[model samples]
Target: MKPVISRSFLDRLFAAQDYDGLVQLSSFFQGTSTCRLEKADYGLPRPFFLIVESLVWFAQADRSGVWTYFEATSAPRQQAMLEALTAGAPAGFAQAYAKGVSGWRDEAGMAGLDRWLSARDDENNRWLWQLARANRAQIDELLS
Candidate 1:
């Protein structure tokens, strides 16, 4: 299936290293559905989908708190969020997320996660963009 967002648009955002834009596009593509998405739904590569979805969830967590993130997030999304954070976010940010998840249903761990995310807000975005740039070959189809 083809993407609703258009490859040219994606290519432009990618070339500009617009991580936030890419993340927003993913949210746009998700529409009103709260369900976890499969790559087949959007036709984006797995890595692209992973990073974008992760950022969306991370941003929500950053703004609302980790407790909220856990409450709304599905099981598959939870795993993908961890994968994206570990793969591209700063070590401490990923560690904080993991630690926070240890007691996700309780406020104890979520408080520290909220603090940690608030302290270093937006820094992880660059790392995710850098990861995409590093994997240019994998996303070359966007360029084509």
Candidate 2:
């Protein structure tokens, strides 16, 4: 089912501009079955993208802390949102996602992921990047 988000909620999200609020908004989607933004038919696509950009900004600002919270609370929703964007949104969304990943890697000094990020000639890198971006918990679990 598509999650119901109100305009006020969107306003609150936009106004928050902090990691705590981002976590709260993301956790709000915890039990959602789907995050098909297009299927949401909410007619507020701009706000949705704004939220995505805001998330990217927050992730860029504090990759380690924000990503830890995201892994713990928002990964599923984020993954689903990316799926929806990949399936239907314009190409810019993917570009935004890539930029977010770039910022995170660069700011966090994640040298280990450089090969994956630098393999721009390989189309598979996109999927790998998406997987890495979405599956931090899985990565940790496997390492453990």
Candidate 3:
């Protein structure tokens, strides 16, 4: 019931966690042209956009592999995703993510991503969902 902000299509997409729907919806928003998660400039609410961005990265990595994410994403976008994680996830969550990137630089590239992936047990990222739920009114209002 979060995102009680707007009555727009964004409200439905966010509440459903409709990944593809949100991706498509984002294109009509302010900052995205390619609907890339790393764009991070959706011109929506800050924490809302950050949460969605972080989850999209999580979702994409879950569908593909973490290495695939790293491979397909540019360094700046990777940095943006990391920043999104920092903004949206619990403090503990950021540690594993940051560690993986650093560990990859430790010359254990694939291993680093694998470790990070394994460390994340909650695929749904209920914590972030909870955040959205808590701020539903604000998010929805903004979208509206």
Candidate 4:
């Protein structure tokens, strides 16, 4: 049987900017669906439906915390995390991407992530933007 929220639902979930609605939808998904949550599935149960749903929700609810997680994490690995977050990949898939990008690390790459976060205009993505704009020192302090 198809999951309560299918690939199309996941697609819309990724594009959703309304943080409140996304939260409700995610809750509905969790309650009504048989799917299991996995970071590798982008917080979804299925790979193709990876939507970064959890991270987006978490980012919306707590920007500083997300940034702290990013700052405390390695740059290259974090780049992959940022990519997965942006690309709307399955939850834990980012770790694999981080492993792939382990060879390259630079301030420019880090800055690019900032720009990417800043450029996101979606309502759901705004929290990510907020987290991105937060000062690194502040993030470190808040997270620490």
lDDT of 1 by residue, 1-144 (tens): 323455676677777766566575455434523323553223445556655655755688777777887777666556656665676566676677677556688876677777777666566567667667676655544433
- Candidate 1 lDDT score at position 59: 80
Candidate 1 has its poorest 10 consecutive residues by lDDT at: 32-41
Off by over 4 Å in 2: 1-73, 98-105, 108-144
Q: Deviation in angstroms for 71 in model 4?
A: 8.0
- Higher-scoring candidate on TM-score, 1 or 3: 1
Predicted candidate 4 versus true structure: per-residue lDDT over 1-144, tens digit per residue: 332444454445445646554454445444433434433343333211222343442453245323444444455434435554556543443543343244224434444433443344253345442332333233222222
Per-model TM-score versus the true fold: 0.67, 0.26, 0.57, 0.36
lDDT for 120 (candidate 1): 65
- Candidate 2's displacement at residue 38, Å, is 20
Off by over 4 Å in 1: 4-11, 24-46, 87-89, 140-144
Clashes (backbone N, CA, C under 3 Å), per candidate, total 0, 0, 9, 8
Q: Where does candidate 4 have its weakest 10-residue lDDT segment? A: 135-144
Expressed as tens digits, the lDDT of each residue in 8-104 for candidate 3 is 5655666676446444433333333323343434444555555555555566556765555556556765576577677757666667666645554
Cα lDDT computed for each candidate against the true fold: 0.61, 0.40, 0.55, 0.40
Rate residue 26 of model 4 by lDDT.
42
**The best candidate in terms of TM-score:** 1
The residue-level lDDT of candidate 2 at 55 comes to 49
- Which regions of candidate 4 fall more than 4 Å away from where they truly are? 1-17, 42-49, 52-62, 65-109, 123-144
